[model samples]
Target: MADPRSQVEHEEEDGASAGELLIEACRRNNTDLLADVISSCGGEEKAAEVLNNTKTVLGNYIYHEAALRGNYEVIDMLLDQEGFECDPINTREGDTPLHSAIRFINSLPPTPPSPDNEPSAAYNLISMMLEAGSDASIRNKANLTAVQLLDPRNVELKRLFQEAAEEAEREREIAGLEAEEHEEEALEDDYAGSGSDSDFDPEEFKRQQEEKKKELAELKAAKAEA
Candidate 1:
């Protein structure tokens, strides 16, 4: 028998291809085919043209598809393409892509998995989008950010996005610190380790490490108590 995915792929090819096809490909998580179409059709520019023709915007296109389907590859593709704006205010609703992504994340049905699989695909996608530069502060037509669009009744999605944003911020901060420390170390090495090779601040380093250990211990205790 013919493979089911192949049959679907054939049908897509036979139909009149357009931006909607691209969107559908994203929704279906068909990254390879999506990339091919986008590349052949001039990528972001062609996508922008489709948006113009459809009276839509690139942000809307990406937000709707990726948000609804938890398609991280598509979201990353859209985010990485330079000059494609995502945080634009919606003309009608005044909603930004961030708002849409949050709304869609909240709407997704929960699919619990065994330990190996993630409990939520939406969480991962949201995290990816944020890391890719989706603005967490952009508000929607309702004067709400994606965080606000989350139903209070569904606290989990709200917490998920919040945690993702916080985690992204933490990662960025850690990277910056690491870079700064590396630069400082490079500078020290440039000094040729001459001015007292014992200039290394062992006390400061130990203090910082001790603080980290204390924080980890507190966290572990909290988790254990919970």
Candidate 2:
């Protein structure tokens, strides 16, 4: 029989190999290789842990590396990972993957419009990241948000990011209103259940008011007489 110690060592080596492959797969936008690496990770939980925790010497996560290269397929797959973080900050520039993506787009030379008028791959990639919950408003160490980092001449991309930010703001407002409504309802329910009104007597309340008014009138008259 194989020794247990040797078996464990082999598994460790396999895991390390798979991790290195994962990074390469992301960098190269190799979805097939990435999928294979995920399978080799032994399970979903392990895959997620590896995907989330893997970082380069420069502190870029796999997601950041993929975004920096405009690797749409790899980014899409990474986003689908059960516990993958959409906005992990890299230590180098404190930039989230979204920021890295914008930087990549900004670096590219201008291209002519597509004949079909379909969005460009960069547009699609950034859109997917936004849809996956990457915050466009998150600022990096230089204090520049992803939207702000966008190339000004790229009006189409600017509009895309602006619309996303607006939509996110609207969603937040709606959520805030919903939370307030729920809070108000809860307070109403608590007030109803508190029994404070159960023993209330309208007649007693009116009588007490009248008594207070009469006392005030008498005091005023005595002061006038004096």
Give a tens-digit lDDT track for model 2, residues 139-182.
Answer: 99999999888888888889898788767665665566556556
In candidate 2 the C-alpha lDDT for residue 81 amounts to 84
lDDT of 1 by residue, 20-124 (tens): 567676678777866776666566665444422222343444446555556677767766654555554545566766666666666666555547755466666
Tell me the spans in candidate 1 whose CA falls farther than 4 Å from its real position: 1-20, 41-59, 110-119, 153-156, 163-226
The numbered model that scores best in TM-score is 2
Query: TM-scores of all models?
Result: 0.52, 0.77
Please report how far candidate 2 places residue 108 from its true position, in Å.
1.4
**Model 2 TM-score (2 dp):** 0.77
**Model 2 clashing residue pairs (backbone):** none
